[model samples]
Target: MTEQKLPAATRGPSDHTLRDQIVNAAMEYFSHYGFEKTTVSDLARSVGFSKAYIYKFFSSKQEIGEVICASCLTQITQRLNAALEEAPSATEKMQCLFQTLTVAGSELFFRERRLFDIAAAASRDRWSSAERYEAWLRETTVAILREGREAGEFERKTPLDETAAAVYLVLRPYADPVQLQAALDTAKEDASRLAALVLRSLAP
Candidate 1:
């Protein structure tokens, strides 16, 4: 393992940066306290802003949740691409993805995890962006697999779309709040196994 630098948000104009501050505070409040238990006021207090000020930034708690998660999702995808650059082989690339996944919860994105938990489910209660995010993940994995195949690092026999879809389904649980929290140690260990399985199945 190496000393990994956490991804830092690039500073933009002050006007646009304030929204990220509000989202950051909401992520903290929601992740530390369950979503249902957290109130808009709690999010406001977390950011040292008044409840009225919170409304100026967000229309509702749900809006805050969406903004917070959307940012985390965008950031995670960016970092995953960065991780790929540091890995020489396809297997190593996939393995580094787990590190990226774990960091999503470790950063200012914890409340974003709670949002992910609800978003991962496909049931009626699933958040609106859940399906869209899942689709994005599937497409990303598919792209990686195709790239590996082109590089002659992954087997030509494996169906890229199918395997990518399976990868998302398999990894979805660990991306959740309860499963990720309860199984952190187990997941850390199993991440190696997961990496091995992906390599064995996909290796050229």
Candidate 2:
């Protein structure tokens, strides 16, 4: 797909300008062509630069994909936080979290499938951002479990962190993008079942 060309630099372009240009172009390329199919030359051509020039801003094309994945994950984390905050209790917050994650995964994996590919790729490579994102998920899950126990919304048979980890493991297939892709056609059914199961597990 064609994009609006960036304006010519009167002097040499700033590093930030070049980096933004490359990133924007790379995002477009990754969205339209998928990450594996896209080439640095294509990104360079889109930004009216040479491949070498593009490499000056990013070490490799995979680096650009990692940057995009990081940005997306940050946004996802923000949304998850907001969803959790909107609920009145920890149980409700956990339910909201499930719905929010399911909807987000559907959007990312079904609507913007290529972006999902990038995230999956970064996850496989154990990129720092991906690791950080996973850590955030676990921490957030544990925090919710602790809040529930403190508020008498859930039982105290197990440690909050252990229970949270177990819950996440049970829910991963429903919440994780790569794992949920095959269930896209049954989105509503899967989401309902997963939410019900988690809510039941956390019930007092």
Candidate 3:
């Protein structure tokens, strides 16, 4: 028989509201103490629950971290999708994509320094949610590239996959927390220049 997988909320809480409270408390704990230093007991106390009670929803602290990671990526995906929808042209959409990444990533990174470390480690370890986010990012980028080709906004002879990969790499610094923090004061300027260069690469 195939095993049944429960929904995130159902796995932990009797209803959605309590699950949200747990998640919010976990986010606060992890942000302040960093995930490695936070204990199940600590989070449980923060939520006024017993360790056993918290376990009803989250199997472990790592699971809580994963949930936070998934939530962050979901927000980024929504913002990207909204930008894509609002942009009148593929070129503008591509521009909006990087800009959105810059703004969103910077805000998160600035809020908690260790958040970047968690995401980087998850990415290196090929965590499922992180990998899923990357796949979505790549597919979305490829869609924009293909749209640009169809609209005569881009004349690149490279395959769409290669083009998307190249574009993602070139703009990595704008969205990478480590790099962004290094030049935090100049981030906007750097991203604007990088965006211009990326657009030029796609020019016919």
Top-scoring candidate (lDDT): 2
Instruction: Enumerate residue pairs that collide in model 2.
Output: none
Q: Write the per-residue lDDT of candidate 2 for residues 1-204, one digit (tens) a residue.
A: 123334475567666777888898887888888888899999999999888767666778888888888898887888888888889998888877777887776776578766887887777788788788888888888888888899998989877767888888866665556677777788667776777798787788
| RMSD after CA superposition, every candidate | 9.1, 4.8, 4.3
56-116: candidate 1 lDDT, tens digit per residue: 6677777766655566566766777787788887667777766666655445334435554
Q: What is candidate 2's local distance difference test score?
A: 0.79
Better of 2 and 3 by lDDT: 2
The lDDT of each candidate is 0.65, 0.79, 0.77
Ranking under TM-score, best-scoring first?
2, 3, 1
Q: Candidate 2, residue 65: CA error in Å?
A: 0.7
Q: What overall lDDT, based on C-alpha atoms, would model 1 receive against the true structure?
A: 0.65
Candidate 3 collision pairs: 12-57
| TM-scores for every predicted model | 0.66, 0.86, 0.81
Report residue 85 deviation for candidate 2 (angstroms). Answer: 0.8
Off by over 4 Å in 1: 1-33, 41-57, 106-125, 128-132
